[model samples]
Target: MSISGLNTLKKGQHYTAKELDSFISTTDAVLLSNNENQLFTDPEREYKVTHELDGFFEHSEEDAEKHFREKKAYVVEKA
Candidate 1:
């Protein structure tokens, strides 16, 4: 998706599965790897993050940054 403004989802906040899915879908990302990873079509990229219980999708540390920056994913940092 081509969001014109800054993101409304805070930097570190948890969101429900439905909410997360909606954001991903609206952004034109295809849920992959059993909803763990997402494939972005426009850029022809795939993002996979390690899954956390309270987070939208599993994000690995290696890929988290890219995923967050590209998809504007809501990432709730662990305490």
Candidate 2:
């Protein structure tokens, strides 16, 4: 989510945590996301990288992709 994108969530409708999470699933950035449980980020793509693979750490985009191809790590991004 972008700075202004946060407003999309706050524009007049009060949302519950579960309802907000549904909205957060479609957002484009992490920091502006409504999901507080999302604390991990890939250093390479910043907002585009939502979750880290279990038991895996990434320091670079290339490394992340490599692991992804090998099914060692996976990421979550909205379509």
Candidate closest to the true structure, highest TM-score: 1
Q: In candidate 2, how many Å is residue 24 off?
A: 1.0
Local distance difference test, each candidate: 0.37, 0.35
lDDT, candidate 2, 1-79, per-residue tens: 3332342343333333333344356553222333334533322222233443333432566454423122222233421
lDDT tens readout by residue for model 1, 1-79: 3333323443334444444445555553333234333322223232233332222444578755533324333333222
TM-score of each: 0.29, 0.26
Please report the candidate that would top lDDT against the real structure: 1
Q: Which stretches of candidate 2 lie over 4 Å from their true place?
A: 1-7, 11-13, 31-79
Assess the local accuracy of residue 33 in candidate 1 as a C-alpha lDDT between 0 and 100.
Answer: 31
Model 1 compared with the native: what TM-score? Answer: 0.29
